[model samples]
Target: MDDVVRRTALPGRSQSPHDKLARGLGYFSIALGVAEMVAPKAICKAAGVEGIENVVRGYGAREIATGAAILTSHNPEPWIWTRVAGDLADIATIATGLRQDNNSKGRSALTLAALAAVTIVDLACANGLNSEKASRKTAARDYSGRSGFPQGLQAARGAARDFKVPDDMRTPELLRPWT
Candidate 1:
């Protein structure tokens, strides 16, 4: 998106300690993303996906939200809250698109879902449910396991890297997918 739109769409890019903290996560995101891009085999093994890594690398808010639903509906962790928040935001965004007059219902739904993902993340962090660092780290760790989802963590990391997600977006402290 254009700078103006990106700046306008979300919260201000203030340089407070909080913003700095979020940027700090970017390193983690980058590492994961890089690992996924560079070494899918090792990452998949670490995370447990003979084929799961490719599927996970394709994740967006919708996928994360679905995972959250499964977690909440069945097996939840304290860390699951982070995914929940992200999912909610994705839903909210989809809702927003549905409300717009000119947008296609389908297109709006997708956009709304994406928006919801980011917004849920914003809410979660803002509400003290989780700090950005803790939340992202938890997400990285939980998602990194190869058993359930293989390449996803790596994919997320790669996405962050491709987008040049700031440090806050990376979350590098989490263990790497491969050694």
Candidate 2:
């Protein structure tokens, strides 16, 4: 015989799923960009896209910019969309390696596949961000009518006029004269 399992509701989340994904992707972008900048030739060899060292370095710079922007922006949706565009650009550039002249079609294909996957993630994150933004816009409340005080202004003023401190509370014995 097996014991019954108990189920519980999940606690509140500090970040939305899209935000978490975006943060992870931002870090990944910076790391990959650094690798591309530091060793463009190695990256090209791995992807089977040779003779584009300068282009790879430029892409690396672009990646770093987008990643930094995403991490620092107050509203990251636009930055995430920027990453999606970057992915498309990368996919387009890598597809060139599929040419008949390039012998490493397998590696290029693999690279393209990976880019496609990343692009999908970016698209999802961007769409989620947009949804969140739309919901926020619709959910805004008007707090302008609120007065911080619980009582109305006139009442508060009247109470203050009649205010009196209790004897014990007015001065603690500890801070009194030592006589």
Candidate 3:
């Protein structure tokens, strides 16, 4: 199924803004995961939390897995949604740090704010992917004559066949809408 998705191309379909953002999120996740894994002590220190390097590393692993999944999947909605869940978990962890005696309250607050910003992006991407998927499904159905496009396949084929071209438009590339 994954191979099929990677191989198939939807004609005349451009990448939506949501798709771009989701891809960006995938990259961001990878970068963050690397940081968490390679510099857990620094991350903990900056977040004003102490003695949680192992926990930070575990979160890093989760981030890397989700990020890789998001990057590879043709339909990234589920993986993006998983990132949202992870964001919530991160926020919870930071909140706990705020209550700890050794933690810096100000730093914890700032971390929470940053996580909130990330959560917003995660949610927007997730919703966008969901809507995009739905529209694709609808388009597929219409193309297959299951719904929409009243005359369906026959009408489509006829339209294509009947379409006239100028004498100067000799190339197939010029005839294709996607071009």
Candidate 4:
């Protein structure tokens, strides 16, 4: 006799269903913005210096809004979040300048501006912020990695071996006293 076996697929390999949904929505909005930006008439209207200014303002506003939101979040990784927000805000301002009054100069600045925007957006979408417990653990790990941290003290934690009192007799004292 022969027997048949069946297996079911497991989730969480690439992305959770929720993450996929969010990404799809985000991409869709971006597509719409691109379409608007590239429209023939829209391009003509915003082609010269004046149009670039408008584009810069629009992008800057978006960055400011997003940065504010991130900064205000109660996430445990507040430091990282704040940094990300500040970076975004900086990029937005640079991008505005890159748009330029006459659309001239600032090639390198424009490149950096785009990079900043992409990084900030990626962070926002990834939801990479950690919880309070995780943040604290990470902080502790970083702190312990510091130099001049007295390895002798850390090693003497349990046994109190290396932490014994000096051999010189002062008052009566116990070496390696137990807690």
Candidate 5:
């Protein structure tokens, strides 16, 4: 029947904060990766690191891959976790730079601090995603076919059929006691 159309959640529904953050990180990764790939030497020089242009370009590639994953994956939790791993690697790289007897120790330290902040955000977003997944799993098991509506689908359909709409209210007329 025409009235029996199936109802489902919309695909273009509003995104949660976590989703927005993940998307933002993905965009950030792509931008940063492009910058690094395009100007690895310049980046390293600005950061006070030396003789690691190849390494910087390698990191740029990794960032591009991670960003693409985050942008395209339906569940970006794993990708975000990967970002956390990348952050750790970055910290290690910066630490190495810090140990170098170059003038870029201060810049490396600042970079490390920034990486720490990004790591925190990545971890928080990953945890939130995991919790949301767990909650969905739990909710799916909460309702069984035989529990709430004991009479089953037919009874539910009958209830829906029995539901009445007041004609006056449908036309936006003044409310009055039903006689």
Candidate 6:
């Protein structure tokens, strides 16, 4: 996008396809995390990955945290980047399973492909968010001629010197420190 168009007023940049994508991905992460955490054994069996329930659960926790941050933050850019980082970690972990001797090699490959797809989406979303610009221009007004006090500084300083405290606002006699 051109710099001029990017630097538009607030409403113009409020909603975009990238924002919706980010939100969708957030919900997807939470759902996937829940399933992974709740049924690690089932996931492992389905994914053909065995004996890694604990690792799966840990990744699930990471996913949930990343998703929550993405959903709750005013700016989800950093959270999305976190997701990208997590994706890389997941890819690395799954790649180890791609060894020829691994019984679940086929499933692992499939999972890696899916992860790659999601990572692409994450990268695109992160890039979109990074490029988004805010062009809100503050109005320039001259306040130099005005003073908070109507009188000059010296007179204003003592203007409230004789002011009396209202009974309602004063400390109770019982709690007073001095007679």
Q: Which of 1 and 4 is the better model by TM-score?
A: 1
Task: List, residue by residue over 1-179, the lDDT tens digit for candidate 5.
Answer: 21111122233342778878889999999898899899999988766678888898999999999999999886788999999999898788777888889788888888888889999999999898777754532222212334466676766775767767876754545556556
Which number leads on lDDT? Answer: 3
What local lDDT score does residue 18 receive in model 3, on the 0 to 100 scale?
88
lDDT minimum window of 10 residues, candidate 2: 1-10
In candidate 5, which residue pairs get closer than 3 Å at backbone N, Cα or C atoms, i.e. clash? none
How well is each residue in 62-133 modelled by candidate 2, as lDDT tens digits?
999888988876567898999999999999999999984868999999999999999999999999888875
How many backbone overlaps does candidate 6 show?
A: 0
**C-alpha displacement of 87 in model 3, angstroms?**
0.4
Q: Write the per-residue lDDT of candidate 1 for residues 37-134, one digit (tens) a residue.
A: 56655644443224445543533423434444432331122334444554464354335445556525666555555546555554444444234333
Model 3 steric clash pairs: none
**lDDT string, candidate 3, 91-120, tens digits:** 988888888996388898899999999999
Clashes of each: 29, 0, 0, 0, 0, 0
| Ranking of candidates on lDDT, top first | 3, 2, 6, 5, 4, 1
Candidate 5 residue-pair clash tally: 0
Residue 32 lDDT in candidate 2: 88
Model 4 Cα lDDT, one tens digit per residue, 6-124: 01112232243334433443444345345434453443233222244455445444444444443343322343444455456545544554456654335536556555765565555
Ten contiguous residues with the weakest lDDT in model 1: 136-145
TM-score of each: 0.28, 0.71, 0.70, 0.26, 0.69, 0.66
TM-score (C-alpha, index-matched) for candidate 4: 0.26
Quote the positional error of residue 129 for candidate 5 in Å: 1.1
- Model 2 whole-model lDDT (C-alpha atoms): 0.80
lDDT of 6 by residue, 19-86 (tens): 77888889988998998899998887766677889999999999998899888875677999999999
- Whole-model lDDT, model 4: 0.43
Q: Rank the candidates by TM-score, best first.
A: 2, 3, 5, 6, 1, 4
